[model samples]
Target: MSLSLEKILSEIEQLTPEEQLTVMGYLVELVKKHLTQAQPKHKWSDLKGMAPYPLLSEDAQEWVSRTRREADEHRERLLQGEE
Candidate 1:
């Protein structure tokens, strides 16, 4: 373990049970937010030619359009009470 982590753990050990729980919850949320913000937000151009398969840009666009249309149709059917 790193020195910083060790010091934090030692300090946490001195806290009362309720305070410890609060600190633990805060740390959990902090770590979660940090990890979420660390994720890469790639643009379409960034991933343009990175697919393993031989898929063209037009092919990808078509797939997206078809998928969205299907989803919309499904949602409409559901909304109309037609499972």
Candidate 2:
């Protein structure tokens, strides 16, 4: 069926608060599903060595490696605690 702004507004006005909320929630989910489906999927092979990374300074690289090591150590501690 054809939809117009006035008709849609009238229908919305006719519904109780709960029905209106339900309709809005369903509409939001429909929009999200459509958007996700519309996005193009990329294959790893399609990217040559994955996207190129910008040149990083030696200091930045060292900082990143240190931070990663610390994070891994912390994660291991957490897992040991959980056990």
Q: Mind giving the per-residue lDDT tens digits that candidate 2 earns over 1-83?
A: 45797799899999999999999999999999999999989887887656445435356578889999999999999999999
Clash counts for all predictions? 0, 0
Candidate 1 Cα lDDT to native: 0.89
lDDT of 2 at 47: 78
Please give the TM-score that candidate 2 achieves against the real structure: 0.49
- The TM-scores of all predictions, comma-separated, are 0.47, 0.49
State which candidate has the highest lDDT.
1
lDDT of candidate 2 at residue 70, scale 0 to 100: 100
Report lDDT (CA) for all predictions.
0.89, 0.87
Pairs that collide in candidate 2 are none
